[model samples]
Target: MLDAGICNYVAISYGHSGLWGGGMRQLLFNTRPSEACFGHFGAVGRYALAAQRGMHEFSSGPETWKHIAMGQRKWANLNPAAIMHAKPMSEADYHGAPLVVEPFRLFDSCQMNDGGRAIIVTSAERARDLKHRPVLIMGMGQHNPSNEIAQARYLAGPTGAHKAGRAAFAMAGIGLDDVDACQIYDCFTYTVEITMQEYGFFGRGEGENWFQGGTIEPGGTMPVNTSGGQLSEAYFMGLTPIAEAVMQLMGRCGPRQLGPETRTREPQVILCSDNGGALQSHSCLIFGRG
Candidate 1:
């Protein structure tokens, strides 16, 4: 999502409206049938629960479980700033934690904190002169499913994420295999798990396995949520993933840097995902070094 309200207005107008008058009105007043018209809440946990319940049926096997736990551990390790940090946990820890919602727990829920981030977008040439090298916005896509979750056909699949990924890959002229790392919005653990599958990072039911074996850590095959994410990092209206993707591309991530040793190359390509309102809505963005 755009950081400012004005950005939404500009997007609704397809960059055609004047600076502050008609565009703003069209965006704020118009009730157009667009993805931008819908919104939702409780994104992370609910999706995880739904995935576990076989509501969407991608993959929820032992491998998937292990990957998810491993990713959580890695996130805890890299993010000393995280609330769950220093609390050694294991598969047993996840299983034993009191259930907040079936298949989720207090720890499974994302941390709530206060923080702010800012980003500047310009041409790749101009980006070089800024504080850091500009990571090009090679591809970006956003989507919304039916607003009423009850009517949604696949709870686990997240049709919106699937569609968004396809659009992003098409726009960037890349594919899932091309991304070196990812920064998925993990308002809840399941959000990440489900996204892994929906974005084509893994086979339908294989996302959980991707999370296992430390696949999503700094040194793993496809490091994800490198900034601690909403799971361990602060929550800022769901824009944190966008900022993290920008940082990863700039090579400015300090403690959570995912260097070449982890994935055999600097993270030249990244995929970022976001979910809105109980996983009711989804968005994906792709970035790369030009």
Candidate 2:
């Protein structure tokens, strides 16, 4: 369309009924006798098991996942639109939750939600005259290691985020120190941990320390998922993070806005991530104030 100048804008819209419509259960697994012999586990169980086995090298145990869960839950409390806004979570509440898989608790997994989100894409000059201030896209990169998660060599550590983040930052011409906030895709708490490690937010195998003491929570050194993320907010897949980043850069987030007063620094630059196919596919986008 841009080639012919038929349209200068593109709109992306998505909606899913994986939660209330009952699509979540039968989508990834079945209870047939033959399938049951291997495992009747669904996406949650399968991903949880994979993460448990794959993350053993960096994580000491399942306890570390709580930090990610509780941190995002805190952000949810600040967002009235978040599904879990009214329900606050504490360390005790997290640990007391029953395990869906061996190492993942109810809080550690994202709540399947039926939600829709839409975004508009246009040229920088066009956006300047739009309704809101333009949110500039600084850089974007993608790295898909493998289509099959089980076959991915870096399934546990150094995910596709490693190369993808490097490319995005290099394209942006900025270092990690310039990043003010993050919008990490959090289908599961462990997803955030692994992605951030590979993004070079901290040293490899040091997530247990980097995630502690509210580092990624609201008002922390690096605020992440200020919209509460897919874990506490609504699950719109990759769009959840992208939408939040757009709102934040435009200074449209009401209660969970990241400003110099609310966060360690004003959100001049933001980082967003989207993961697909069991972390085998990764995409990074760097956004800056426009």
Best by lDDT: 2
lDDT of 2: 0.83
Model 1: which ten-residue window has the lowest total lDDT? 9-18
Model 2 misplaced regions, further than 4 Å: 1-4, 26-37
TM-score of 1: 0.77
lDDT of 2 by residue, 1-290 (tens): 75468899999887888776765656445445654677745557556755776566665355667888888998899899999999999889999999777677888788777778998988888899999989988998899888654466775767889999999999999989999999998988888888888889887678788888999887799998998899999888789999999999898988788885466576899999998867778999999988
Worst 10 residues of 2 by lDDT: 26-35
Q: Per-residue lDDT for 145 in model 1? A: 80
TM of each candidate vs. truth:
0.77, 0.93
What TM-score number comes out for model 2? 0.93
